[model samples]
Structures are given as C-alpha cells and as structure tokens.
Target: MRAAVFVFKRFCGSSFRLQNRGVCDVAVVGGGIVGLSSARELIIRHPNLSFTLLEKENELALHQSGHNSGVIHSGIYYTPGSLKAQLCVKGASLAYKYCDDKGIPYKRCGKLIVAVEREEISRLKALYERGLQNNVKDLSLIDARGIREREPYCRGIMALDSPYTGIVDWCLVALTYAKDFQNAGGSIVTGFEASDISMATESPAGEPEGLKYPVIIRNTKGEEVRCRYVLTCGGLYSDRLSAISGCSTEPRIVPFRGDYLVLKPEKSYLIKGNIYPVPDPRFPFLGVHFTPRIDGSVWLGPNAVLAFKREGYNLFDFNAKDFTDALLFRGLQKLVLKNLLYGISEMYRGVFLGAQVKILQKYIPELGRSDIMRGPSGVRAQALDSGGNLVDDFVFDGGVGELGGRVLHVRNAPSPAATSSLAIAEMIADELEVRFNL
Candidate 1:
C-alpha cells in the first residue's frame, strides 16, 4: 500500500510501471501497422497500464508496411464469412475516418477487376456473388461497356466495379499509429530485436507480490524488458518468434517477392485507379495488376516469385539459411509441384520485362514495353502449413507451458492486414483480454 501511494505520487496521470522491478504491464513486439495499432488500442483501453513497443529496425514500418502498393482494399476479394472479409470492409471505413481525423491524405480512386476472356466471365460472376455475400460496399458487376467507360484504354468482357477502393501510403498510416501510441504515454524501442521470451526468475526487493513481471523478453543486443504480459506481431519471423516461446512452428513463414513496374510520367494518365486481373482461385496471390499510388506514380505488376531471403527485395538478394529453410520445407515442395508451370513463368517474367508487358497489353492495348521501367519491389511473409495450404486468415497461438499463459502470438496475418489493422487490433485486444486475463 505504501509503495502504491509512492508510485502514484511519482508518475500520476501517466502509464504505470512496477516500482521495484521496473516491470511494464504489456510488451508488444514488432513496429508494423498491426503492432502499433495494437499498442495504441491497449493504451487507449487501459490508460493506467504501462505498454512498450519493440522494433527490430532503426525506424518503424520499413519493410512490408513501407513497400506495399498503396491500395486500401474494399473487401471484394476475401471469402464470405472470413475474418478478412468482415474486417477489411470495416477497417477500410475506419482507415478512411482515421486518415480524415489525422489529416493524412488519401485518394479514393476506386478499382476494377476485369475479365478479358470468355472463360473468365464465369469466375468474374462468381467473384461478384462472393463480394456481395461479403457485403462489399457499392460493388457492382459491370459489362464490357462499363469497363471501357471506367478505364478508357482497358479491354475486358466483364468487370467487378469496387468504388470504395482507394490508395494511401501505408507507411504514413503506420507512423501515425505510432504517434498516437506515444502520445498516449506508450514507450517505443526501435532497434531492439527480440530473441527470447521466458518466465522471469527475479523479483523486486521487499515486494510483497512475487513475480510481478512474470515474462522477460530479451533482444539480440542482450537488452530486456520485464513485463506481466507480451504480444508479438513479428511479420516475417513470426514462426521463429513462436518457436522461441515454445510453440509449434509447423506453419513457417515463406517469403515471396513481388516486383512492380512504374509507368512513364507521360503514360501514367492512361491508367487511373486500379485495373486487376481475374485471379486464379487455386492460387493465394492476385496476378499482375495496375495501381496508381498516392504519390502520383502508376505501377504495374507485382508478379509473385519465391525469394531466397525472407526480407530480400532484390532478385539476387540471398541468405543461405533462409534459402535452405525454404528449399527443405515440405509444404513449399508440395506447393512448388502443384504450381510448377506458373512458378516457371513467374521466374521467366522476373528476368524478361517484355513478357510482363505482353500480359499488361492484353488490357490496355496502347501499353508498350518502353512505356514502363523497373520499379520498387516488396516481399510477402506468406505462411504455409505442413499440408501445403497457404494460410489466408488470422492465426494466433501461445507458448506450450507456463509461458503460454502469459504470452500471445500473432502467427499469421495475411494480405489486407494493413487495410484491416484497426479491426485486427480490436480483435487482438479481445483475445489478449481473455488469454492474458488483462
């Protein structure tokens, strides 16, 4: 009671830390959109509790969050009744509002998923039904005339018009969340790569309560934070992080590289908003698409190819361990066998720019090889199970023993994670409350 009084007197109206052991209430690992949003949600919900955010990089949102093509998804692509479907729709609305409130600019230029061939019409119609079932706002099935009206140069037999889709810089949005968390008295420690999580062994002197900080998280630098609970959002290294917590590592993170091509400034006007292909249902990836960024740059492509390194963005970037891990994974082997032809083609397109352009010209006949140049690329932290199924939904887990009761792991948050970050945060916070009894 005496310590409580002193603690209140010392740091009133701010986040609280255990007086003797310097233990925080919660420690959030990773500084991407989900991590920042979750940290912000925690502080907002539990203002008196101390929260700390740790990032491996020197700055926040430098990897996936920063490299993505700035499209605010409209929930049209996700399956009905899935978390991605519900959260994406709700999160897009929340994102727009948050951007509005924060004065972060974004453009709601809309999107069109076009079907060029007759065979694709059935798939396009099925997709429309799926979008309607998912409650995607203002989604409509349009004919060839409508496609031409929306995209003057685009040729298609049918299209799904998603007017709610937009573009925003995700890196900017993530940084805003970071700001909100900090303003609410949350602590952020960049360059702290978390390497271990274990039950705390030490207690504060004269503390009546034993093991106040029951969890200790150590970084690669040997620095540590003592906290009562922990939440991890390790995007690319999520499986490794889970293993360190004594959890199953069956669903490993496999990196996929997506390369984009930027349109010449003079030709950028030819493509407005987003023009996407009717994706193959068997695959987890959306094929090459045209997207206009918030920065006024029009990008084409993002062909999916296996990356040698988990975080590698360039074609030649390689990590021996990463390559070995991916090459030996049973799930990857199965997936490769099933999609060998597609994989070979993707690899071919990666080397030859003209092959990709040839596909692009199918939609926009005026697009020439010289109208585009090599642009930025991004690496997707795709999770795969032993059964060779690509995880397309949120996957959460915890440690195996005592550590399990104290920590929660966000193992996989698939695409549209950025669009659904706020909603994802809300869902995660609910789980945190139940799992950690916060």
Candidate 2:
C-alpha cells in the first residue's frame, strides 16, 4: 500500500494521486461542486466506506458551479428560517474556514444591497430584517451618503452593509474537494455519463432486491460501468433523470441564462464590495449588481433571460425542441404573463448593451460601454410547478415503492445550493444510509 501510494504520488501530486483505484461503496453522479463536496463529506464521516464519483465532463465544476459569480452569499437575500437561509449561513461559514485551511483563495469582501429608488426602500428594509432573523450579524443600514463613503462613486437611496458576505473562486474550491476525496481513498472518474438509474430496496437480510439498479454509465471512451447506490446531483438534467427512474412527478426545468459584464480593471474600483439591488418580492433572483471577485476583478450583470436550450452558453445557441417545450409549458406562459413588464424590460436590456450600461451607471456613473467586457454566464435550472408558479425551495422526490422503492431523486436545487452544498450532502448521505442500511 505504501509503495503504491508513493508511485501514485510520484505520477500525480500527493493531493490528487489516485484517479482510478477502483469502485467503492458509494457512487456520486455528477462532478460539480455539490457532488464533489458530498463525496468528501461521505468519505470523511465513514472512512471505511469506499466511494466513486462519476463526472461526464473532463473536469469538475465545468458548468453552473464554475460559471457562478463566485459570491459567498451571507444568507441575506433568502427568507428567514427557510432552507436557503439556513443552509447558506452554515455553508458560508464552513466554506470560508475550509478554504482558509486548505490555502484556497477567498475574501470576506462583504456586500451592499442598495435601493436606488424611494419605492425600493421598503423591500430593502425587509431584506435587512430577514438578514437579522437569519442570524447575519453586523447588517448596517446605509443611506446614500453612507454608500458613497464606502463606495465613493456609488448611487442609491439606501443600502444594507452585510459584512458576512464574501467571494471565492468556486472552481478552485471544487478542485480542492476532488483532491481531498481522492487522497482519502475515493475514486473520481471523469467523462462518465450516467444513462439510467434502476431502483429497488435493500432487504432486512442486507440483500439488494433484483429490481435494484446497477447504474449504467458510459465513459468518455464509451465503456459501460455499473454501480450500486447511485446518488445523482445532475443539476439541469435532474428532472429528466428522475423521469428515467420512473417517477411520476413531471417537473419541467426552465433555463434562465444570466449574462455578465466584467468591468475593465480601471473601472473595478467603482465597487468597494458587492453591490446589489433590492430584489422584487415576486421574483426569487436578486437583480443585477456589482460583485467584486476574490481575484480583484469586479463584475456586473446576470439578467435573467429565457435560454432556448438547457446548456446554451452562446448568444446564438438554441434548440428547437427546448424552445417549443418552453413556449408550450403552462408555467412558462403564466410566468411571462404575470411578469410581462419586467420580462419585456429584461429582454430589452439583454439585447441592447447600451441599455444595460445605463442600468449599471445608476450605481457607477463612470462606467461606459467600452468599460464593460463580456464575462461568463450561468444558467439557472429553475423548476416550474403544475400551478405555473416557480418552485422556490429545493425539491426532491424518491419513487416510494415504485422501483421496489430505493431510489431518492432530487428534482431541483438552485441558487444558494452552491452555498449549501455541504449541508445538502449531509442530507443526501443520511437518506442513502437509511435506504441502503449501510
């Protein structure tokens, strides 16, 4: 074991030496931060348990987790006592500590939620109160002058100074988790795409039912491998995966692409910290704002525009089927009609970069069209309900007694999910333990 470890270390650094030491007691599908974090927690809690993490991509955090704004949210925006609030607060603290200990770059840069108009003041105050209830300490209400004091060029009627907010490179964090999971005798297989999941229960005698799924996944090379106890964190395709598991719940995933603009280095000083708008009570997303990344580059944006495809990254990208489904879906129709004005405004702002610049200049008067560079975008996999309302919380549905009843399917996990990754993992691991009696 020592010689093998040494040889492995000589080839691949001591941190990520093991790539395929073989399968284990657990198989985590998806190599995003959430899956990697879950794998790390599972191995740490039960060292005796062997684990395997399968990712369809060549590297982890390649999608939403990596594309995010890198903000270490302070649990300020979420409703108090909700899962988002609870998990975000806990996750933020744990993330900072973990990053610090692991030598990963991070900053408690704090944040400012600004109300630019008189009408936004009430919502700003409500968010402030909610932050307090969520135990976000040191939330100070800052008037326009106060905002200018912190961010000299900023504009706003009032703002909330949340010192608990911060930023970190999520890609780095996910890589660290991969390294740790591998070092702890866990297997991480990249380019392994899970095709289907079969479900069944574990008998009292510890025998897996014949209906039990041995997850069939094809590697990048098209080689198929089977595994027991498949736990999926498939992000955008979660609902589809659940359908494959024979679950009746048909929650449609609507993709909302958030476009960003990174302020040129010269204009980066416009924000002393994170600057946000008082979110509309009707919507879950906190409108576009300034986020000072840990790397010192400031970014503005994330206009929620409907994407024609699930994984559409480019402006011109589209899928005929995806667009047709979205247009036909009752929830999508209702969402558009209910927020027609806001939706129209968002769409107009998205196409005309000059319009977006005006919105930015509301806070940073110095920003010009040339100062904004095209930054990366992230797609939110928002789940729509039968009632045509957007599902706000994380949604999970396991086929109870359907596939002999052993599969737990997570249909929706968005937003603070990246923040609540560790806690979410604990939840997944606990449920799996009971299901498999391991």
Candidate 3:
C-alpha cells in the first residue's frame, strides 16, 4: 500500500477521486460538525495513524449543520440524565472555548423560555429545575418584570433565563473542524458518498499489508476506501448506513421540516436574544420560537411539520422514496396518530403566515402577520423506534461479527446535536480507544 495521494484545497468545496489512494487507519463517514470533530480528535490523539474524512456531497455542512437556527443550546429541555443533556452543557462550554481558540466569533446572546399562561408556570419550573440538574450555567427563574427587563416587548408570567445560551455560525464551526482535521494530517475526500461497509477476510492483491485495510467502505459511484476502521456520523442517512453494516435499523431516520418566518428588519429589535415558549411535554420538538441569529437578523417561528423529502426545504418538495419511507413507517404512523391535532396545528401554522404570527404574538404582542415573511428552512432527521417512540437520545452502533470491532455508527443524535458536537467527539474518542483498542 502507498501513502494517500490526496491534497487539500482548504478543506471545503474540494473533491478528490480515490485513485490509488492509500489505506488509512481510520475512515470517518460524514462531513458534518460531529464527524469532523471526531476525525480531528481521533487523528490528533493518534498522529501515527492515518485518517480520512469522506463526505457524500461536494462540500461540507451543506445539510443539517449548515441550515440550522445556529443556536448553541444551553441544555435546558433535555432529560436530566440523557446524553443530550450531559453533552450539551459540556459542549456549550467547549464550543465557546473552541471558538475562542480558533478565533471564531460567536455571541452569548442568551435565551428566555417564556411561560405565557398561568398553567404553564409549572412546566417552566420543571424546565428550570432540569437546567439546574444539568448544570446549565447561570440559569435563573425570572418573573414578568425580569422578562420585561431582558426582552422589552416580551410577555410572560415567568421565564427561565439561560444567560449563556448563545449563537454561532455552525457552518463556520464545522469548517473549522475540517481545517483542524486537515491540519492534523487527515485527508478530506468530498463526493465520496458511502454506500456500504464490510470487513475483509484477506488482504487485497499487491498490497500484501496483511488485512491492514480490511474494512471495505464503498460509495454509490463504485469508489471505495479500504481502511482499517470506519466511523459513520451520517445524519439523515444514518439508519441506512447502519443497516448495510448488519445493524438493526429499528430506530429509523425520519425527516421533519421546520419552516421559519423572519421578522422584518425594522421589527427585529422588538425582542432581544431568543424567546421560546413553554414546551408541551408530549412533543419531541421544542415548539415554535423566536431565534436571533449571529448575523444580526432575528427569526421567528420554526414550526415542525412532516417533510416529504429528507432534504426538502419547501412546502411541496418531494422525493417519492423519502415520502414512502415516512408514510409506511409504523413508528411515524403511530406518532402522527397520537399527536394528530398537534401535527395539524404545526402544518396549519406552516401554511398560514397569520396563524404563525398569532403564536409569536403570545410573547411579543407587537408582532403581526405583516411584520414577517418566510425565512430559510431546515430538515431535522429525527430517529424513531418500531413501537412509535421518538428516540430522543444519542444512539451508536457498530453492527455485528467482523465489522463490529472495526466500525461505529452514530445512529441518532437528537436535538442540540450541534451544541453537543465537540463534547460528543471526546466521548467518541473514548469509545474508539476502548472499542477499537486504539
């Protein structure tokens, strides 16, 4: 085997065909923030081992990582002992530090989970207690006057103020991880859509490396990376990747599109920082909320609705296979039936601008339908179990038999995945050390 012949062009928008590429000790299968972070960490921790990052697209972070609300979540809403809760609190701190060390700019713009109704105060209290249990920094239970002090036009009987909840260009953060991975001598290969992962029984001809690159990682275009170990952080396609590797896809990836309405620039200043509603415990998603991006523009209302396509952004965007998969899935079917009214309400809000503004006005009475217009949208890859439960935690798998020891699949990383990425990478590094005997 030869050393990898790939060269870099600043780690994004660059594609290299794997022509006679050398076998790497590890091949990371995803180019999003988490995959990049893990690859960077793995390579940095084991510099003697060669590594490569394989991205399906021609660029990185072009999906979930790029199209998010860019909020560095403060770990307020997750179950107290869950991976999301643990990693998000620690990841937020690490994200801030990483930005500091990388000179990447971010804003600790803060967030307020406002309880508009008297009955909602109990849920708000629970949320506050959960934040405390999770060690979210500087969480405070503020009254109506305190909410007014923080967001002048906002209205709430009570609110949980997360002073350290911040915003950043996650795409920038992901790119920085790509840079770090490359800087640490890890090769980045774009346009390498991973189609399969299988362990080898014997070495390939002429290599004579004694099964050194035994793990066969293939792409749809017939290209492959023969590596010693594989790590998949596939976001939307995680289940497919896992299934092909002989793992159960019981918790399948279901795409849900969230559509946002941006506040008119003149009205952007009505509220400061993020303003969220008291979430209903029945729902997996945090209901529609106001999010101020790092770019100074304020956005309101990201109503979650069923997406017809995994990569769909528009109301009518459709992929037959994606639609069929969602429609046939028993978990999604049961989920929709259970939350029928809630799903209808989300869909209604997504369709009618006035309906969405009405909800937004709950917090800021000053807002109206005319004060906002459609904004950018993103597809959330939610994982669902066969029994119709939303899998609301981190799920990792490595299949069975020979490949079990050679690959790891991040099957599901719920909301706050972006906030938890760096910390999640540290956990992945620990897993690799013990699982792969690194």
Please report the candidate that would top lDDT against the real structure. Answer: 1
Candidate 3: where are CA atoms >4 Å away?
1-20
Cα distance off (Å), candidate 3, residue 242? 0.3
- Give the CA lDDT, 0 to 100, for residue 117 in model 3: 94
Name the runs in model 1 displaced over 4 angstroms.
1-22, 204-208
TM-score of each: 0.94, 0.89, 0.95
lDDT of 3 by residue, 314-336 (tens): 98999999999999999999999
Candidate 2 local lDDT, residue 22: 34
Q: What's the C-alpha lDDT at position 360 in model 1?
A: 94
Instruction: Quote the lDDT for 366 in model 1.
Output: 98
Best by TM-score: 3
The alpha-carbon root-mean-square deviation between model 1 and the true structure, to one decimal in Å, is: 5.4
lDDT per residue as tens, model 2, 69-116: 988888887778788788888888888888889988888888888888
* Per-prediction CA RMSD (Å): 5.4, 4.6, 2.4
> Per-residue lDDT of 1-438 in model 1, one digit per residue for the tens?
121111111111122232222358999999888998999988999999999888887678878898899899999878899998999999999999999999988999999999999999999989999989988889999998999899999999899999999999898888889778878988777667999999967675675798888788887867677898999999999999999999987789999999999999999879988999999887668899999999899999999999999999998999999999999999999999988989999989988999999999999999999899999999999999887789888999998788978889999998899999999999999999999888
Compared to the true structure, candidate 2 yields what TM-score? Answer: 0.89
